[model samples]
Target: MTTPLRSLFDFNGGVKPDYHKDASTRLSIGVLSAPTEVPTELVIPLHQSIGGTPRPIVAVGEQVKKGQRIGDADGDVSSAVHASTSGTVSAIEMRRMPHPSGLSSLCVVLETDGRDEWIACQAFDHKLATPQEIRDYLRDCGVVGLGGAVFPTHLKLNADRQGGIETLIINGAECEPYITCDDMLMRERANDIVRGVVLMREILGAKQVRIGIEDNKPEAIAAMQVAVGDCGDDLQVVVVPTRYPAGGAKQLIRVITGIEVPHGKRSIDYDVQCFNVATALAIYEAIGLGRPLISRIVTVAGNVDAPRNFDVLIGTPIKKIIAACSPLPDTNRLIMGGPMMGVEMPGDEVPVVKATNCILLGSNKIFPPPAPEMPCIRCGECALACPADLQPLELYWFSRAKIFGKAQEYHLFDCIECGCCSYVCPSNIPLVDYYRFAKSEIWAREKEKSLADEARDRFEFRQFRDVRDEQEKSARLAARAAAAAAAKQLATTDTVAIPNTEASTEANEKAALIAAAIARAREQQVTATPQNMQQLSAEQLAEISAIEARRAEIREQAKPHLPPDA
Candidate 1:
């Protein structure tokens, strides 16, 4: 009898397209020699992952090592960056980065010295460490998902133990076309990948370990099977049918086991935590060898003379990688990452970031140019192909009208931008692009709102300060009045006899001086408008003159009674 379909819990409705993964997977992973002249100017984007941007730790002209911390994770939801090679920080300024917008971002440029050196890295005793300790160590080592998302790996592994994660799924499904980094990694470093999975199992207290590989990569499957044989029955190697996007965390979870991760729920919620094969290798390198993630396997393919997977250092320039690959004549489009999710580069000056997975140089003949976008024809193909089961047509309508709030109401944030909708769109509408635009617009508005809120806070704080100052002035005036009354009472009780006429004259003179000062202060406080002053009417000027004259008379009356010492 034939075995039942392994992926019973996989959600219905997914697109299956030709995945040309054989280009780079045919060759074993080759160790890339450090470029003789590593690009001095590195463009490190602030957003290299799914969480908060890291804060730069080094300034211009500061020297950094291969594994030295250059930027730190800002909060619980951030990832850190390490220097790819020993180099001096040349600059920290905004430059064009490898993003969908071709936008400028704050980047740290490093001038490498060619000598690949490392800084001090701490290693933990795995046997003696607690779950929290393991998580902390992974965080410090800059361990994150190597499957393009770049989520901090420690956070995923540190799920609630009460949930009881029984199985650890190692995703070896390199399903993206023309990208074979993960496949090559498993074939070349299968033992390390297994060790990483075992390490994860130890940390998560997982009972069983399952390695899932697509049947297209029989070599990788055979290699992994051989590697796990030494580890015994706790580890099993399973081959699933080749399918596009089969490597997605949720898809792989469903295919390997019959457990479905509910909507808006994590795979760990179903007692499963899926990790990419490359990520497992990185974890093994980090924990076993006490090394941070400084390098990764990158597939350099498409319209190139050499299509191979190389273990390239992070922060390597795109120009350098292209130069190494030696693209064929008539090369036009240069995209970073896989063909489906990769972003086109404006120029070759943009340096490689932590998320640079593949560099595809597409030529006219090999890779046909994308056709012009046509209006949606309401075919429902996008909905059928949607992995998340969202209505792409509805989203397209809302996004075009700039109705972001309504788009969000339809669960716009759930879109992973996997390009399945666009891939299957008969009209070639670029549905994913529209969704991305909508999301970006929403984020921009949110940022503006935050800034406005901050400004309002500052304004309120200033008003509060002014009110407090006024209250303080009133309190001081009250205290002075009370003190003056007490002094007058003491003077009346004292036995120092004086002429009442002289005392009255002295008091009158003091009152005249006080009245004159108060009149001057009131005059300074009055702001006369040009119109009002010009059209001053005879009555207004006469009133001012009368007040002046009365003040003069009062001064004259008290002049004789003024004390000689006053």
Candidate 2:
């Protein structure tokens, strides 16, 4: 077995909250990997990643097998979405997304056929394929960061720049309370994870790799070490202190590599890259088995009698998953992620998307409401606990006062919303919530500014086009007038010398041709008859002749008594 790394570094400021992971880790995920029973329906959301939302490729009533692409990746920046199981598309309509905003978005509702059939899968030969080809393949395969970020994985495979990545860090910290999907994954599927790590390292062309797990997960660390035994000397399993939010990419990188990546700068700039263990497993499956990501391991704990981790389909309803967990009474709300950073879902019926790592059922007993807000006494507890080394009090004050510019100036976006600041604040200011509000307002304003710029550009273009059209029209009129004046001068002036007899003959010939054309046109017009009249019956012809004769006889009689002009 590979030996764990002894050298380790530390970062400034982090809290050690109750992990609460043991409740779900007691039993293996195998019992709930694939439930004996199936969900009646799977409402797969089209937008699951950080980039553009995948466009729906399946129409209503269309049958799709498991792992079949139901939503095509929008662009290189996006990831594809797939049918969780064999099913018929019942609707392509708006459904509530599992987010803190409780917003509804486009979803492909599927009525399950209960077959759980899969589409044909062929492994991608990354050895023979180019980097761009591999990225495109993974994007189509629906591979993304599964450790709650849900960033399209193919984008991270890019090793084209950043002075080349020398280190690849696999994050198995799972630092959030009550979330053990990654921990369980490393414990059971370490071999598969190792295979994925090798693939990722090859993709990034990294020379060395480090897998960092919290010291609390001894079993996971042992299993991963055993599996990684013969990989290479460059790859090591590093045990890190179990601290809340240590699993943050930057924090984990700091603890393992001593690389302090700033907010704006990227880890790749320091020749380092990080991936979650679950994300590694996903990469392995995509390149090895060719199966797209249609399911994930989700921890359903808190306010449940028997908390467990389940391998849930991407679009399976949370309520359906909860039904299996024997939810305890007084379960007030359903949270879609870990306690620290997870969003309280709008409803239990919200289907799990790719970002869902845990389903934290909340109640007053489990997560009691905070006491009434109190004025801050300039306490530095929040600042002390901040892992990013940011001043939480200043951010809180600016956000509360609606001073977004000051908040942003204070590096508001750097806050990871880990809830550490809020957890430690004596005044119970809900510091993270205020920070989140400021960030959202800033984003909304930026979006508006972008839209306004686009509209202004369109208006200016239209004005320019109108002016251009008018200028062209004026130029055309001037040219036409000049042409007419030149023609008149040419006709009036003796421009060419010719014999009188020849000129006369030419003029006569032109007149004769004009006359002949006009006569022919007149003859054709006169001969043209209405189709109805031309196809008259014999009785209609006879009736017309009799009427003509009667009219003629009447005219003859009237001529006898009329004047010569009449």
Which candidate comes out best when scored by lDDT? Answer: 2
Worst ten in a row by lDDT for model 1? 1-10
Tell me the TM-score of each prediction against the true structure: 0.80, 0.86
Backbone-clash count (model 2)? 0
TM-score for model 2? 0.86
TM-score of 1: 0.80
Model 2 regions more than 4 Å off: 4-6, 31-35, 159-164, 230-233, 495-566
Model 2, 1-566: lDDT tens per residue? 55643678898888999989898999888433253456888899999999999999989999888899999999888999999888799999999999888999999999988788889989999989987899899999999999888889898888455445888999999899999999998999999999999998888888889999999999999999988985554578888889998899999999989999987998877888899999999999999999999889999999999899888888888898898889998999988888888888888889988999999999999899889989998789999999999999999889999998899888999888999998888898878888888898999999999999999999999999999999999998667555554554456458754335856645544554566569899999899965777888999989988997999999898876758797
Compared with the true structure, all predictions reach lDDT values of: 0.79, 0.87
Q: Write model 1 residue lDDT over 3-116, tens digit each, in one string.
A: 224543455456677776776676667666365655655556656766887889999999888888887877777777777778788898888887767888777778787776
lDDT score for residue 69 of model 2: 94
